[model samples]
Target: MKNSIAILLCVSIFFIQCKEADSNSKKPTVYTVGDSTVKNGQGDGAAGLWGWGDFINQFLDTTKVKVKNHALGGTSSRTYIQKGLWKPVLDSLKKGDYVLLQFGHNDDGPINDDFRARGTIKGIGSESEEIDNMLTGKHEVVHTYGWYLSKIIKEAKSKGAIPVVMSPIPRNKWEGKKVPRNNDSYGLWAKQVAAREHVTFIDLNEQMAQKMETLGEDKIYGNLFYKKDHTHTSAKGAVLAASIITQELKKTNNSLKDFVLENPTIILPKKTNIYLIGDSTVANNGIPEAVGWGVELHKYLDTTRVNIINKARGGRSSRTFYNEKLWQAVYDTLQKGDFVLMQFGHNDGGHIDQPKYRGSIQGISDSTMVVTKNDSIKETVHTYGWYMATFINQAKEKGAIPIVFSHIPRNEWKGNSVERADKTYGLWAKQIAQKNNAAFIDLNDSISVAYEKIGAKKIKQFFPKDHTHTNADGASFNASIVVICLKADKSLGLRDLVLSQKEIDRLSQIALNTSIENKK
Candidate 1:
């Protein structure tokens, strides 16, 4: 009876060990490899740039499997393997692990150049060429792009791991109505390799291109690419690309699809505030008949998403606005994700240090002027550009986006065309925005364009009593024009927060009718 009991205990222990081992083996991981678009610097999304590999985990089921992004920037199919970057990744793969491969952006460089030397022979042919390594000073044989990709697939499969081949994401190059794709080159070869190897394939290039077509060139260029670079993606673009990959993975028959999250919560951003600041042209004149563009701007905005705060005061220049503690109040209430629209220059053209000391020096120079206030207190004033720059830099420090607008044009016309301030304050405001990396709107030029289109005689109705101040109807018209400008500006990200085109048209017509009524 004792011998039988001991045997039964040993059998129970053996079965429990087997079950634990089996459970451990079932826990798989998905590994990613490719170029900069797959993974950029440190993969932390620094400097407004990002890569899809860093963001894919958000849509994955981490409880089921882990995700590891092993991609390196500036690496191609040839160099990635040649430089021993793929060896560690391959060594880490287990029986149930999955690998995702993407390349091609850096594969088109010179084959033996010292700077990069990342190029691979075109096509999936078995052809290879001997070349002297410019960086390592060793003789090496470079294979075709297809050969490099095939090697990865074969090695993964040999290790009992599933391989998913993906075509490189498309660049921000557009051809007419659509973004051009790479279906003829790397994309075609990648798909062929997957089919030849009997592995799952994803057309990431085609998918991203289709998405780009839907987003249009404006959103793609403004929101996706890093600055003027068409290759790398910004944080927003990277998230979008990762989301696309998640969707494609769900369509596959592989076991990895079971690890994708279903109905993941999409986080919406908090509401933003839009603050307007400038001179009389942007202020709320107390009289109902006399108004400013700032007062009427809220009518064209989506109040649910953004609150328009017109903080502009009449007869206040950039210097006075900063010195009088008006800017301090606005700055105190400013918060992250807020927007400041600054338009000054109408009241910044007065003489300095002579009783009415309101004017500031021109240009972006660091020049200063001494002035006496009403209380006989002496103060030093900086250039007009300096004050504007101060406002821009302060807003940026407070995590708010500052947009500079040129002062509206006076009721002055040279022949059939309305004169513009593009040479003076308009030009200076644009310079300040560029220097400070802020968004700029040429309100002076935009209003002038409308006036020129309407002709000098008919456009005079916009100015009721003075050339600098507009009547209520004219304020609404200018405000609608500002809305049009915001819609056209891709970098502002304010298109969705504005009223519909139909509403804008209706408001414009109403303003025109009011103008006629006021004239009568």
Candidate 2:
């Protein structure tokens, strides 16, 4: 964690020292021009939608070339030429600079309407349409979509600037899971214009559509585009589109290829991520005998509504998990309204001052202890309750709902009932949760009831290896109980994500093989 912070600080200091020198000697600029899909609503990510032009810079090595977005919302190919949005960009182009052109989103609107008369003629021919522009109240001659694009390419070349033409990105509309392409109309015309002008042309429409279809429609619809919006994209969608453009640009022999960053980052559509963090009791590594409740929990969740990310590993207590920065990884990705379900305590009973070094102190208090390892590195440790409180509080600071789950009950039994943790780890977890005002799921208590029904003799099958872990059938049973508890808690607002009782019962039985597991 300290190393990451130190690297960021060094980068910040370098930028501060070189700010004036960079301003005095600006690098070559790559200017992008188009409509809303290229640069939406002031290019500030308003309404959770942005354009590819706004994110293209993240894929460029800014030390070699800078980027400028000259695209405007609600402008078509003909209107961009008519409204003088392209003039300033053309005037500023230098000998070695590059200007990208991608228009056509709004070119299909009514040409002579009073609302926004921005449409152009249908084809690439020299056809012209004379209209008394209803919006501007002036005589105007509109050209074809191809003609408007050709003018930009030719004019940009006349000023000694390289021009690259691109087809507009595809909309969220789909036909039987296949993205509908614009190859027949605007794409064909844009390609023809670029060929005639002898400039580089990128078919972003077709290319991006292929990627979208492969990524699946479920991951795209609500995540990339706002619900009910076919056009425009969320910030995540913009990043995906920009990544496609950067990939295509570097493939060309153009000078801009030298400016593209090596191994540019590709961002997928953003969704609400629900992370499950804990020990091996919550993880599955293809071990049939050691399946976890977190693995079987996927059977009951509405995957389309939220992403279930299981970050749980084996043999990690709350203290060791935070100390190793495993919790930091999940904390970095938490967005407002996301959820974090944390479970620990499987390994918290290990030795703290010894070589194993996984245990925390006993109770829920702001207490600390210092220990030295065999390598002579000194570390400060806290109580199990303090670590639990830290997890709950940090999650709240990130605006994520933190759910405290007392670790699942083991197979050990005392006489008639399964062994309980109320006197130990379970009590501490509950106290920390109450103090933090967080939701607590007493897996140790609720799961024990089911175990007690089956009795210790019949439950031995779940723990073939030891008394700690459960088999696949037992994991499914525990997961069903967890779902029921989640649905009853209305404060979490996750009732709609749980499966119906009928489905839950079917999955919990694990094909009716675990009849003895949750039998009435």
Candidate 3:
């Protein structure tokens, strides 16, 4: 007994010393800059759409360094710095910290007097002077896009931060059924600036487009597009994008290169308590071999960080999600920074004459009323707004960041068009998010965009022939969509968990291997 105790104590001390030594080693800090495409939640509602920025987190070891994403919606090179978002970061920059800058989408906005005008001409001294007088609303000077980008590089370098430039990701627009190049546009411009500045450049646009070509349009839709939008990637697509960035980074930064894993990072631990609370799309008891988005979420998250305790019972509205103590059960176990994603509204559509499941009657209302059930208790079905808001509000009350998803889409995708939301659950959810200032994900719009690009025939592979519920591929595909939305939402702080290409491949391979192994 004495010998055993002494041996264990010695081993423990050795590990403790090693951990201390490891902690002392300096890790590099990564700061991000970009427009809405790289920002969080810009493409939330699209089916599988997500910004690559969100998935970048997974590639880094959090123990070594912190990754801060300051990207926001509607920001272009000209606006990001002018809005003062870049100043605080520049001021806080420390030696050896890295700044990864991406822009282009919003930078393409026309140079109008409107707030949405983010576009400026490309090149080093390119300038189009526009002046709006006072009362013309926020009179400001708009610089050329390249000039603004150059400013960011100059400022970041002054602060002793290493600047790495990446081109904006390519949109889904195709020339003769093939994705085009940024050679004549933003991609070329970004490269030109990087060359002039002596900064490292990652051609994300070229890399993504090339990979998409290799994957082929068919595979690209399966791996990338959330619902229909070709420009953005699904969770799977983001993972793939992150992987490409990692591989490119590895060619130079050897330290980060080895951290790549062979799995997509969704490995689950047995008895992990994951609680799924959503509408029919995320609930249990959907069609056989057909599960909700939540059902497949466990496949991407690390099991060590989770417990697969699914509480997603079917046929429950957002009101019922909490009334039945579903959120309460998950809330009880939540630790600091734990996530509770609330998706609903497949069944909360306009109900004819039925008080229950009806949208907010009397104009976006959330007034609470009482009803007595046969059980002799007063029950209430809160307005769709009230139900969703309450769930998010309560989750936040429990110290959890409530991620609000604006309902997964129905299978009404055609070529470049989706069945418009038509003032049902999708609209109501958006209102709930805005009212509470909650982190809302627009899955509906993102998916609709995707539907338009992929068209009706290709979408059939993802949404199922029955037009409801997804297959394993479909479920995994939809789950990727959710990840993409969360990644872009910036509010979710999920950028640190994004996976690299090798890591994604590893994760995908592992998932495939695990499935194969299970089959055997």
Report lDDT per candidate: 0.85, 0.85, 0.67
Q: What's model 2's lDDT at 476? A: 80
Candidate achieving higher lDDT, 2 or 3? 2
Worst 10 residues of 1 by lDDT: 263-272
Tens-place lDDT digits, model 2, residues 90-187: 88988778898899889999989999999989878899989899999999988888888888888888988999999889988889989999999999
Question: Which candidate's lDDT is highest?
Answer: 1
**Whole-model lDDT for model 1 versus the true structure?**
0.85
Would you list the clashing residue pairs of candidate 1? none
Instruction: Give the C-alpha miss distance for residue 59 in model 1, angstroms.
Output: 1.7
TM-scores for the candidates: 0.57, 0.52, 0.49
Instruction: List clash counts for every candidate, in order.
Output: 0, 0, 52
- Candidate number with greatest TM-score: 1
Candidate 3, superposed: residue stretches over 4 Å from native: 1-26, 42-48, 126-128, 133-136, 253-520
Candidate 1 local lDDT, residue 371: 76
- Model 2 off-target regions past 4 Å? 1-26, 223-227, 266-520
In model 2, what lDDT does residue 387 have? 89
Instruction: Compose the digit string of candidate 3's lDDT tens values, residues 1-520.
Output: 9999999999999999998876654666777778655654653423334566666767766566667777876778877886798898898787777788998887776666544656676655667676662323667777777788888998888887789888888775566657898877888888899888988888988887887777666556435652235465556666666777767877765344444444435311122233557765775565745667777766565332355556666667666666778767777887655667777776665441355543333224867656655566666656778777777787678676666777777776544577756477777777887888777778877766755664666556555446666556555556666666655655566643433234443544444344344444
